[model samples]
Target: MPKHPIAVELEAINRDGETQVVRDCGLPVQGYSVYLRAVEASGLALATWIADYDTIGPAYQLAERLSIALAIPLTVLVPEPLMPVQSGPAATTGVITMAN
Candidate 1:
């Protein structure tokens, strides 16, 4: 199956002492292009970088290595599935409905 796009966010400080959060979204191999652009433009000093994805995979590993090498804090954000809701009739009738 094809992998989902991952989002990388960086909290950085610029030359003016202003702080901002920059983000890039793409496949793992593409790297963090948007954040790099911000770095080149503003000379940002990274405070922390966050990797948000659905699963623990290549993107997570890459972020961890980059954090270690750059000596920046890394935060991983993974989503949890929502629990199914039980309603009056549906709960007792033993019937299920799925949407397409």
Candidate 2:
């Protein structure tokens, strides 16, 4: 059987202009994982859930709760399947943004 785990990450940029993962909160079976990060440059926390389409709602909820608790903005990134582009410009990856 496949496992659906949520991975949490807290990242920031150092003075050298390199992005670093300051904390890896590990994978949890379910529920949300929240972390406090600095408000400076490139300081943010992220939770990535890889699961079936049915779990998208829960993922959004998790992100929403984290955003509200941290008083920060939230952005959901959903990867789209690669397909043949028939015309004009290819479709760009879509994103959902929410502010708290």
Candidate 3:
């Protein structure tokens, strides 16, 4: 198999001081892809449901139902919020004064 640039190497020392090398198979995809691939590779059981970014209200409810039906774990990927950027001294100024 080809090597991945971002792959991490893990070594575990047993009681006899024996070292074991661990190989990672699913480190490339994100969100649903990760769960789906893991299931397909026999590393994990079937993924009944998955909640992608921006899943809210009804979407969450539906996922739960599917999870129960398929007897698989429900994966939810919460997205990060974006904050406004501040630039210059006026960025924090709530009010501006004009020269009279």
Instruction: Give me the candidate number with maximum TM-score.
Output: 2
> RMSD (Cα, Å) of candidate 2?
14.9
List ranges where model 2 is wrong by over 4 Å.
1-54, 79-100
Across 1-100, the per-residue lDDT of candidate 3 in tens digits comes to: 2221211111222234333221232222222211221233434334221333222334434444444444445443322121123366633333211111
lDDT of each residue in 13-96, candidate 2, tens digit only: 233533332232232122222333333234444344322222334544544455555455554323221112324332122223
Supply the global lDDT for candidate 2. 0.33
lDDT of each: 0.32, 0.33, 0.29
Count steric clashes of candidate 2: 0
Candidate 1 Cα misplacement greater than 4 A, ranges? 1-55, 80-100
Q: List, in order, the clash count of every candidate structure.
A: 0, 0, 0
Q: Lowest summed-lDDT stretch of 10 residues in model 2?
A: 77-86
lDDT of 1 by residue, 1-100 (tens): 2222222332323334333332222212222211211132344433233443333344445554554555444433222121124355523331122211
Winner of 1 and 3 under TM-score: 1
Comparing 2 and 3 by TM-score, which wins? 2
Sort by lDDT, best first: what order? 2, 1, 3
Q: Clash pairs of candidate 3?
A: none
What TM-score should be assigned to candidate 1?
0.29
